[model samples]
Target: MLLRLPTSVSETQEYLTQGAVPIGGATLVWATWQRDGFPEHAMSLRDLPEANTIEPETLGAAVVLNRIDDRVPEVLRRAASTVGTGAVRRTATVGGNIVGSTLRCLLPAALVLDARAVILEPEGVTETDLAEVVAKRQLLLSLRWNTPITSNYVKAAAEPGGPSPLVVAAALHAVAGGGTLLRVAVRSEDEVFSETAAYHGDAGETLSTLWDGSLGRLPVPARELVGRQVTELLARPGGR
Candidate 1:
């Protein structure tokens, strides 16, 4: 396989347009490669300055997980902190996390933020909801979101050296006309079990409508734990 590390977005797009894949962190790459095999050509975005930018409205695709700090948002910080051990956190990239299906710790938090992604492809740059990016496993350039008001996150225990924990994350935001909107997500290891709630008056209404009784499908232990977490999270100041 040929590996091309491009330093500019234009160069990167050129390579991708020619059918080269983008690789970041290489954590998921190595594993998937061992199982499947390598692409004919791959491009590393490490040298692209745009891939490392971190700001309030944007998180670069190659931004290190460990670099996410308190300034971003509590829910995201909490999720990033617990993605894996220190080594994994330092090595993992936001694009890798979003693009690869292996790890999903950040998905719940990102969903609750109502994030959008800027994507680059053989065609050109396009912007869309983050959910679409994850679904299609597209090349993500950056993630963007409005700053949230109040947010909370909870997760199940992770085994040592394990993948992401089961996460239930929520955040509140204000809409026009002085009203509050809430976003909520439930992510298991393999799939996102619940659709993100887009602030339905209060937690109860949101939960009832969004969950649509799907909580009953989880194993007893998970159901109970997630149940407690949902209760506590909504009961806090944000839900009302």
Candidate 2:
């Protein structure tokens, strides 16, 4: 396969605007690629330093999954560890993960993190909510979030190494009036449900309500898993 290597962001943007696909780690693209169905033009982002830096409030799109553990939030790290084996993590990138899977894999944790995407488009650069970019599939440059809340995640799968049936994430952060704010996200098979509100001494209820609204009649097992994780998140340092 022919590859275009751009030495600078401008050159990379030029290639992107001309309909070239941007490749970070390229793990996802190569994994699902069919015979003779590869992109006509693919530009590698490895040479672009901006897409690989890990900052306090920003995670570049080309950051590999394994490096996320020490550089990113705890909840995000946990989700990244579950993507695949160690070798896969080494080659899979944050940007590829964001575009490859809708919300089931890493997006749930990112959602609770209040993440936003810095996208490099053909026209120019723009900042957008992470979920909004799900449909656009634009070229993401980095991810940014302000509030680093205490949060945790839980996933229930039918078998060992099988697909997760239910995945839930909950977070607690400071709000006005000296109270806490609760943000939760649930990733089911093909959908994602989320809710955020000022903590009024009722987090489990909000989670259950969101589940019921999104998927009618939450099963006992799913409820228990979500409850345990939410309980842990609330008990974390400075939570509630």
Alpha-carbon lDDT, every model: 0.76, 0.74
Give TM-scores for every candidate, taking all chains together and pairing residue i with residue i: 0.84, 0.87
**Top-scoring candidate (lDDT):** 1
**149-201: candidate 1 lDDT, tens digit per residue:** 77777778877667556777777787888776666677765667655445655
Q: Which portions of model 1 miss their true places by more than 4 Å?
A: 34-37, 159-164, 195-240
Which pairs of residues have clashing backbones in candidate 2? none
lDDT of 2: 0.74
What residue runs in model 2 are displaced by over 4 Å at the alpha carbon? 102-104, 158-165, 202-218
Error of 1 at 70 (Å): 2.0
Residue lDDT tens for model 2, 1-240: 568887777887799877887776776667566644888888877767878878767888888888885566777778888776799889888888887654347788888888889888877778998877877787888888765667787766556555565887777767756777777777765577777756556766655555656433456666577667777777666675
lDDT of 2 at 37: 81
Give the range of the ten consecutive residues with the poorest summed lDDT in model 2.
Answer: 209-218
